[model samples]
Target: MAETKKYVRIKKASVDGVWYADKIGNVYEVDRENCVSILTKRGIRGLSSVLREDAELIVTEKRPAKVGERVLITVAAPIGKQAYETGDVFVAESLYDPFAKDIRVLGIPDFIDYNEYEVIVDNELKNGEADGMESTYVRKQSEGLDRVAKSLGYVELAKSSLKQNGFIGEVHTFDLLTECAERLREQAQTHKEKIERGYPEFSPVHKSAQARRDEIVEQAKADVERLRENNIRLRTFNISLEVNRKDRSVEAIAKRPKSNRAFYGIAKAAPSDCFNVHIGKAIALRRALGLGVPDEYLNAPQPAEVRVGDVVYGKYSEAYYQLWCEDEIGDVSYEVKIKEIVDGKYRYVGGGYDFIDDADLTIIDDSREGVVGE
Candidate 1:
């Protein structure tokens, strides 16, 4: 069956009017003069600037928003207005004014165009047009009117203060300043807590010091184990040449190959072309030799009897070996041992020697059916 994708429903606000929301609910107001289209048609840049300012207002000052959190905007006046006398919730309704036509509701991703709004407001104030909305009256019920008045008065006072202090007469500036102040306070509190806890300097390195030490130790152990497992042996022989000075005669002596000579155990060596040896092969050899064997191998039971021609199998590497059985048979099963061990590979070698099938090989200390012994 195919999987289905999930979707979430998000509320949209009109771009035509001032969006306002109270504890009761949200409301939209249509002011043709301040509609999104007018701002866009006159210059999309201007509209973008307004949106940026509004977003900063919501984030830095009015109500700080979490990242990706939904922000609701309404066209009605701010909360705590006189029009809310009956404590009636503000609801969006059609405007009776003809000038309010052609307003639209738009849904946009949060934080989009925030910087643009700042720029537009900044440019407008620089051109001495920041007071354009001073005479704009938003129609509402008595309580709503009172709330709007209060909100507007607050906005005016804020603007006047900025102007007197030589700050830009822009809504975004006021909102951003408020936001900066709040952020500064939060940071100050956080710093104080860290200092009280005896942490004069707070950094990622200090926080993860212990964890980093543990990680390094673990890595070192892994590297050592890897090196030990990869170790192999190399075989070297000494050739002797005899010379008789008086007779001017020379003789060369060659050494016979012994059973032990066949086994070249070294820390590292390339596999011979006659036999393929891989990392798995090296591991299996170590296990068969029982040299430096791990505890897991030490706990395992030893074979009842390992004949010359018997086949030795490694469970982990899936490698198989057949030993030459006798001396008369130059390549007797017990004498000639063929070992196959390689990383990421399995090998099979059997010639009348006791051997287990690949499929039956397992780590558990249990025997499978049809084996020579239980």
Candidate 2:
């Protein structure tokens, strides 16, 4: 069998000088100056230390680093083919030696547990030890300063909350409370002025009582005059004359016609003979005339008696006749009802009328004909 190859995941070392972490804890940095082909031939182990400080280590899985903690190094590179060919080192969790100070050979703890306290390499603690046992006391003093800073921050935040809430509450209460005080002051002043002037406050009940007394006096006087007028007109007799239109004579004993109801008004027909007769009013006139058929319909053109295409005209005025005709044969001139009048032009609907028989109907154009009549 052929030699089995180990499979390793790969990742880019950097993007635009920014570093990323890979599966393993070891970090690597990329240099834009070196190409992949050059790095593969020359190898990357020697260059690893120079770039180590700039490399950022990112732990994707729950490995050594906590959820939000980050490593101080730069970019991470993948393992396997490209990395191997490029002479890039593959990192495993066990291989990191973090305790070693030299970047050339580093070591890490055997295993890291999350949320557990572990002692990191304290370079400052090591440097301070040279100053003797007094250096320990200085370290404790530095911790006290940190606590003071945190406490001051919380106090300042509380003061800001008090000022912001106090200002808003004061402004709202002052505006509404001041307005109520001014209204009360005005009412007190008005009451004092009314008392000094010796004038009673105007009230509707007092005015209504006085008005009722005056109304009763006027009503008594009107009742006395009304009785006197009733006695005078009651004795007066009214003589009305009924004229017989056929005989052109008046009847002495004739009572008023059922159609004529005006008593005191002059007996005269409507001044304007032209009147707008609605359908209901025309029906009433037909009943009074004892005409079994409606006069409006009787005057209307008969569709059966008239030919399919016949011309008829309306004598609206003595000088003009509005033309009505059919445009086609087998077309009847049905009932023409006036629907509306707009701008002195009467619009009517002709029922059962055909336009196919007569295409040309004479429309009287007086202006074009040069007629003498106005």
Candidate 3:
């Protein structure tokens, strides 16, 4: 078996100052026998003759990274022939041998992906993205919101296209993102309320570990009292998990006086304690913008029909969109919807038809007052 090793990205460089290739990819080869290769140390299979602190690419490029004129370019290269996934950022430094037919290009890959960068941008973690999100800590919280707001590849592109096409910032959406954000806030509020009601472990998704914070607090007080009565100075008390030998049942246990912050940080919370963070964020943003949630959103939204004679707009548009038929296609794919030209150049999908089946517009669903002419 050819040892099945896969790398999402690979950095190739000329080990002996002999590698060269084009910036696009596919490096050049000089002196076939003594072609570009990575230097070998005593035991390390991965040794580089490259100039930077990056892993050595086995091939050099025309855009060589010389000692003084180091240039950087971003490109994709698969190591062990692994296919590239979305959001992979690869940068390269190479030296081209213009004198001869071959130029040694040192490839440098910074292999940073969204998930591995340790920031949660998926719609799932929007509200509480801060609990453990790195971008929030590294940058400002507003930047973090913007990052997650346009986190999806399509979402980012749609925003960029709307802005580029002179659409107002508020209308920079192909779907009812604002309405969805409000919906997220409502969801977050519910989640937050449940947590406040001593049920931090509650979640619509994921199995929740029941919250025993109050019980823990009471137990902590009793523990401190017991220690005081026993003539032991209760310096600090902390809660921990212990396995019972009687029935092999694992349960939380309260112990004493570990550190100054023990009692405060000792309470039991939901697992990961980061549920509904994004929803909270969405809610806050909507309130800041003077937006309110629909009354129906308080409970389940009633099914509404999209019909003819209604005016609508594309997810990202300033021109009002017009509908095609007087019939109802309340739920259908956006691709099937006919395009009504608002202006000579500006066109939009016929309105009144929901794009829930659309790969992009499903984020909005039926929230907000969107079924009628706007």
Best by lDDT: 3
Give the worst 10-residue stretch by lDDT in candidate 2.
33-42
TM-score to native of every candidate shown: 0.17, 0.15, 0.15
User: Ranking under lDDT, best-scoring first?
Assistant: 3, 2, 1
- Per-residue CA lDDT of model 2 for 1-374, tens digit only, reads 22111111222332233222333333222222110101011133443211111222222322343221222322223223322222122122121246322121012313222322211211111111123323433443344344334433543454456567775466554454344334334444544454454323341111122233233323333442443354346633223334332232222221234444332311121222111112222222323323342222112111211111222223322222223433333333232333333443434445332232332222111011121221
Please give, for residues 4-102, the per-residue lDDT of candidate 3 as tens digits.
Answer: 111111233322232321222322111211111212231233332221111212222232222212122223333454544332322211222343221
TM-score of 1: 0.17
Candidate 1 Cα errors over 4 Å, as ranges: 1-161, 165-176, 200-225, 231-374
TM-score, candidate number 3: 0.15
lDDT of each: 0.27, 0.28, 0.28
- Per-residue lDDT of candidate 1, residues 253-327 (tens digit): 322234333222222211210111122233333433344423212111222322222233332221232232323
Report the Cα RMSD per candidate: 30.4, 47.9, 28.5
Model 3, position 147, has a per-residue lDDT of 32
